[model samples]
Target: MDTITLWELVALAGAATLVGFSKTAVSGANTVSLAIFAAVLPARESTGILLPLLIVGDMFAVRAYRRHADWATLVRLFPAVAAGVVAGTVFMLWADDAAVRTSIGVILLVMASITVWRRRTAGQQAREQKGQGEEEGRGEPAGEGRQRARLKAGSYGVLGGFTTMVANAGGPVMSMYLLSAGFRKLGFLGTSAWFFLIVNVAKVPFSVGLGLIDRHSLLLDAGLALCVVPGAFLGRAVVDRINQRLFERLVIAATVVGGLQLLLR
Candidate 1:
């Protein structure tokens, strides 16, 4: 581990606050924290150190919105996500830090694109089906809706697992999916809070095996975790005021920008 200078500590504090804010309020912005961590620490070590800080933020989130989770959706996605975690572990074992960072960037960009395209196409399909149904004197069809849900769950699950393992960047990917699925307000926050808490907790063994978490990293995580408290409180206050559609669009845009930087850097 490198010696932490005063300036780097300040940066880490700022970044940690942003991370807590992003985790509970606006998620896509956590890229700021990711970049700061990578800048201040070695890439491999950064992920390990950041994980505990993230879990601290997650604790705040879970406390704020624990009552509104959708267990069924989480259960449906669990198996595929587990598969993704295994795949991510394999990739991390073999790939160098640069490769892992670049891969995560590319994955984030691709996932963002898929989410945008999916939203547009789904809207068009829904509109077209609605028109057709009016001509047939029927109500909105259930089959089309089911097909959309299935496609969304599968795509989101794969991307979420990959980005999370590689960069701890699953927030935006899952946020996009939950937003599209029409989870409103507290439900979105609650569901996302629990989902990430579980997934991140499950990742501990893999991170430990990869040597990402170490004694020094744990020390850093402790200092960073303190900054999460203020940010998390502010996030809880503002979460209900957020407009779901607009927040999601901003998240997608931020994810693309961050992903591109990671890839190109």
Candidate 2:
């Protein structure tokens, strides 16, 4: 680990706060924290150091939104997520830091594009449905919806698991998945909180075995964890002030910028 400077400490503290805020309030905004951590520490080491703080944030989130979680969605995602975690672990064992960074960046950018495109198409479909005076499921086949939902679960679950295992960058991918599934504000936050808390806790053993988490890393986390308290509180306090569309746009924009930074760096 590199020696932490004053500015780096400040940056890390800010990043930790963002982790908490993203957990409770903005779902995908923690890509900024990932970027900041990568900038301040070695790429792999940064992921290790960030994990504990994220867990702390996750706890806050789970507490705030535990009631609103969609267990059905979680059940659908877990098996595929496990597969992705195994794949990511294999990749991590072989890949260098640069490869990890570049791959995560590309994935983020691509996912963002896909998300934007999906939203546009969904909007068009909504307009057509409105024109026909049809309710959401009036004409669509139930089987088709079920199939699409399953496909979404598998695809996003795998991607989310892999990205999170490799780069702590799964938030945006999962956010995109949840948004496309028509989650409302509380449902989105609650479901996301539980998902990350469970997934991140599961990653601890992997991280330790990979030599990513240690006493030193935990010490660093201890300091930064304090920052998360205020951030989580603020997020809970003000989350209702922000609407869904604005939140989604902000998440998308941040994900894009974070990806570009990683790619260019």
Candidate 3:
């Protein structure tokens, strides 16, 4: 940890700032931060170093968008997420985690495809409803809609927990979930902020037991956390200007990029 050069620190500071930007703006964009950190430090050590920085970013995100959170969504996810976290802990006991990472990457790509299909289907349904007129058209059955939501919450929640625990890659997974559920920008950001802040903080004990977080990592985090503040402000300043369509496109694009990186790495 002590051997990082001046240029390396510069790189880390920049990455740290992007951590905050990602938390507030486009959630999946922090895969860039993940890549930067991996390049600068040992991959394993980088995960530990980056976790605290992410928490700092999460704090700022929650403060800015806390009121917009969807509590019902959070409630639906926690149980499944907890189970996945435990599974991830066992995965860490394995000698190699390559298979798990590959599986997550593949799942991410599949989820992205599903989200696209769902959006198109919904748009088509909306158009058909408009053409059919209000009296003839009907909404989705409440029971069916509830069932689908539960299924999605379970699957995405487990995947989100496992990927986050294993690789700090949960953001893209959860972002896809939020987008699929038709959450608007502030709601997406707010729910995500609270979700990750809680999950990441919860992972601390496991990370410590795994020897991934320690005094040295915290020391590095202290310096890097400062960079996140500026990025948070930058994201907040520009978020309102981003129309919903563009925001969703950027989230999906980042999710795909993150998935490809994980798959190809």
Candidate 4:
């Protein structure tokens, strides 16, 4: 902690504040925080320092949106996420910093592209349906819907687990999943709040096994975690004012930026 320069400390505090804000208002914006921390600290150690701050943010998010969680969806995702987390831990032990960063960056970009394409396709379909005055066939067949939902939950849950375990970069991926699932503001926040709170907490023992959390890291976190409180409050204050469309756009934009940052950094 003492080795960190003043500017670095300020940057971390700012990023920590964004952590709080991201939890409550914009879910994906903390990719910026992730990038900033990785730049200021050792990439591997950055994940450790950031984890506690995220858990703190998660606590607040859960408290605010606990009732809105989609427990069924969470149930479907947990097993896959657990598998992914284990795979991610193994990968972390095997891969170096560059490999981890580059791989995660590529994954983020690909996920973002897929999400954009899905949104466009869905929009076009909606337009065509409206133009044709065909509302009866708007929803997919029940079987098809179930199949698609399973596919999405499995794919996204695993990826969310892998990326978050490796670099704490799961927010964008999960945002894509939730957005594609057609979650609204409160529901989105609520489900994600519980999803991450549980996933991150479950990751604690593995993180410790990896030596990612320790006394020094905890001390550093204690210094920085307080900033997250104000940011959370600020997010809650303005979140209701943000409309659905704007919220989606913000999430997508942040995801793109986060992917780009990782790829280029």
lDDT of each: 0.76, 0.81, 0.76, 0.79
* lDDT of model number 1: 0.76
- What ranges in model 2 sit over 4 Å off? 118-145, 243-254
- Evaluate residue 113 in candidate 4 and report its C-alpha lDDT on the 0 to 100 scale: 73
lDDT (tens digit, per residue) of candidate 4 on 171-210: 8778767756655556678889999999999988888888
- Per-residue lDDT of candidate 2, residues 1-265 (tens digit): 3588999899999989988888888766687788788767877778889989999999999999898888888999999998888888888887788887788677778767876776676675555445443222123322457888798889999989998998888886887677666665577778889999999999988889888899999988988999999999988898878675777787778778877888899
Where does candidate 3 have its weakest 10-residue lDDT segment? 133-142
Mark the regions of model 1 whose C-alpha exceeds 4 Å error after superposition.
Answer: 111-151, 241-261
- Looking at model 4, residue 74 earns an lDDT score of 86
Worst lDDT run of 10 residues, candidate 4, spans 133-142
Q: What is candidate 4's TM-score against the reference?
A: 0.83
lDDT score, candidate 4? 0.79
Deviation from native of the Cα of residue 65 in model 3, angstroms: 0.8
Evaluate model 3: give its TM-score: 0.79
